[model samples]
Target: MRVLVFALGEDDAPRVVQFARQLGAVVDVVVAASHLSSGAARIAGVGRVLAPDRPCDGSAEAVAALLASLASEYDVVAAEANSLCGDALPRAAAQLGAPMVSHVVAIEDGALLHPVQAGRAIAATRVDPLFFCTVRGDAFAAAPLGSHPAPIVPVPAPPAGDTIRLVRAAARHTDSGLTQARAVVGLGRGAANPAFSARAAALAEALGAAVAGTRPAVDAGAVPESALVGQSGRSISPDLYIALGVSGAWQHFAGVRDAKTIVAINSDAHAPIFEWADYAWVADLEGALPELLAALKR
Candidate 1:
């Protein structure tokens, strides 16, 4: 059997190739060179790699078309579940009239295992050969690199086929990767102001923590929406999470539910954040933060 993997983001080529290796011995991978390192060809089980000279912007359609065209040659065409794969693979599946299984956690007995009901249960799905699928990011470890690496065969940028094209590109501002941070400082409405947020950021820098925020804090521009921590935003599983001036509503709490330790600081004695916090400090943040920052600096 043979498989093709579309590579992007943290759900990257190596891990997806690790997943592909289970379905087939010959795992041929495709990657957006801009998003994935060419070093993916060196992974242990991979057979070949198709990468563009430049993973040209606005090439999602082109990549989807290419994967669809390759369907006949490979038993499975798959990617790790990410924004890019979530968009491109479905289009490939549509074009080829192939079944697409998403959020796959494992392959068991010729069927894919998917998480259901917020990951409380698993469902087994049997998809035919020549299908499209996306494995979840957490499904596999990266296929380790070895001394001998495969040759990186460059694929030309395919025509976007007169479909939607890019008129311009603007870079989005990025914060520290929240998912990989060991420690996180979460700002609620208490740090929504410029002065308060700045001090909180200083404290975060001292603690070596990434900064995330609640909706009100994001609305106040205390932190970007990308750093927002809530049910609607990114979920984090950090070793330490500090909540400041936050009222622990379920929506915000849901994102940090997996944190190993939670510390809450708020002036309001009755703030809901204290209810479930591992450590609670009922004190004014304006006074408390400076002391903490000073202590860390010292």
Candidate 2:
């Protein structure tokens, strides 16, 4: 059987393709409508790649066309449950009359697994035959390594058709720093002040960490979009994630829940973020930051 996966550079390539191959299927990729930074020709374990049949405008249309092309040849199609491609999966699945499951965190017992209860629990679902799922980030443990490297082939552009027109590209900012950071400092509404970010930056620098913030903090202009970490923002799996004055909204916690270690500092001990954190610090952040920085130096 053939499986189609969305490609964006090499970041999720290893993980997404790994999952598809585990199901004993050959993997293919769908390219973006716009230009991409990386080419998959050299990547191993990727068979044929399918690009937009026609020059398209929106990502959804481009993906739809690719999925439609593969529907005849492949038994299933898969996509990562991420912001860019999340909406497309369900819609395409519906259009093709294919069964689909999203937010899949694991796969076992011939079924896909999903997390529930603010990511505190998991639920297993069995999809109908001839359907696929969108895998959640950090959901399941990776499978054993594979030795065979599949050849990648670029698909020729399809004939012109009425498609979503392309508009001027806008610059997007994300907290990519947190993705690879060993430590992260997350600020929230409680620290929603221009002054706080400066102090937070200092703390981050001293600790050799990257800076991140909750949705409210970014919305309040306390931090840039680049520092946002939440459901509506970037997901971070840092080794150490530190939250200062963050109340820990469910949306915010989902982004950092996968961190290897988490430390939350807030005046209220019952803050929701504390439930998932590894260490809790109940104190005044204004007073704690400077001391924390000083201590790190020693």
Candidate 3:
């Protein structure tokens, strides 16, 4: 099979390429950034790297057009299931009159396995050979760098046309550590009080963990939306997840289902989070957090 992977110039690009290569497909990458280290392509085990003359400027339409033009030459088109590629691949599929699958976790026996019903269930789907699909980055390991670098093939910029234009871009002030951290300290509704929230942050710092929160915590203004971990928020696979005063709603669990070890600290013994936790501590977070912090320091 011939696979075209829309590279986004990060770990996601290599992740998707690794997935395609696992299927024994001949993989080619089309980088959607202005400039990227060709070494990235080499490490991804790609046959060729198709880079644009300039950066993509966050234009999904341009990417869609490029994918649409190249769709016919390849048996399958794939990308990372991220905000940018998620928008482009569907449009590209529409242009090719092909089916599209998003958030695909595994490809097995000619079927795709993906999360359904807000990640409460898994669904298997089959698509035409000539189809577009996006792979979940966390599901696949990064492709190893090879001894030889892949050839860089420059592609022309997308023509300017009637597409939504980005007037300006501003960087958001959110803790990216929550997404990249191996250890995450999660706050919930129980930690809604300013005092308790501050303690949570302190505890997180003491443990060298990134601080995150549930939707309720975000709604209560205890943390930014980027720190929210739930069905509508970012999914993560931290090595250790420490839930402080969490109720353990399914929505929240969905985000951390992949966590290797879940430790819950809540006053209520019967809290739903305890059901999913590998370790449970029944104590008030306001008091317990300080003790935990002191213990860790000692």
Candidate 4:
């Protein structure tokens, strides 16, 4: 099967490469060249790279143009399941009249496998001959670097329309240190108070870690929208993940399930987060966070 994989951002390249190799297809990587180059390099092995001529940001116009450019090249299209490229995949599928699946973790038995019921249930869905799917980033390991380098090829033709320009961007700074963070500290609704946020931040700072939160905290204003960690939030798979007062709902679990190590802190010992966590600490978050911060300082 020939697969056209969309590399939405820098972080997306690794998993998309893995998926491409798994299908054993010639991979066509569609990218916004100026914004991302690693994605262009990662899938060079498959040897089909399609980049836009204009400065295409992740916009509806850009998506439309990209779809137009890539229409005839491949049989199946896959994307990194994320906000930047999420809306584009579905729209493209609808336009091409192809079957579409979103947030799929795997492809098994010749069908797409996705999580349902807030990630509590797994469902397998089969699409028609022409298929489009968005894949979860942490679901698979990136393709390993080989001894021989993959060849780089230029994409044919320029983009059709003018590039989508960003008027202004108020980039929200996240202390969750998510970009290159090796360790993460996640706070939930039980730690939604302002005082709790401060303590969580302190703990994260002391440990040189990033801070994340559950959807409830974001919805309740405990943290900024960027700090949420769940199905709707940013997906993280750090070396060490510390979940404070998080109940381990499937939505939240899916985001962090790939972490190498998990430590949970909650007052209730029976919380579901503990079941998946490597270590569970049943304690008051307010009390525990400060103590942990103090201890880590030394």
Off by over 4 Å in 2: 33-39, 51-72, 129-132, 140-181, 192-194, 198-202, 205-213, 218-236
* Residue pairs with backbone atoms closer than 3 Å in model 1 (clashes): none
lDDT of 2 by residue, 181-232 (tens): 7788888888778776788888888888888888788889877664577665
- Predicted candidate 2, C-alpha RMSD: 4.5
Q: Candidate 1 or 2, higher TM-score?
A: 2
**What stretches of model 3 exceed 4 Å from their correct place?**
58-70, 159-181, 187-205, 208-234, 266-271, 282-288
- Per-residue lDDT value at 230 in model 1: 55
What is the clash tally of candidate 2? 2
* Collision pairs in model 3: 34-54, 34-55, 43-145
lDDT per residue for candidate 1 within 45-156, as digits (tens), equals 7777777555534345765876776668888888766444556788989888888887677889988997555444679999778788877543476778866766677776
Q: How many backbone clashes does every candidate have?
A: 0, 2, 3, 2
| Higher-lDDT candidate of 1 and 2 | 1
* lDDT at position 61, candidate 4: 55
In candidate 3, what are the lDDT values of residues 1-298, reduced to their tens digit? 9999886545556778888987788888877653453845676468888876655545668778878877787988998665556677889898878999877888789788988887978899987689998887668877888888888888775665623332111012122444457899898999878999888888888878988889889899997655677665556788999998899999889888999999999999999999889999999886898899889889
**Measured by TM-score, how close is model 3 to the native structure?**
0.75
Clash pairs, candidate 4, are 176-210, 176-211
Q: Which residue pairs collide in model 2, if any?
A: 45-150, 57-164
Lowest summed-lDDT stretch of 10 residues in model 3? 166-175
TM-score of each: 0.68, 0.73, 0.75, 0.74
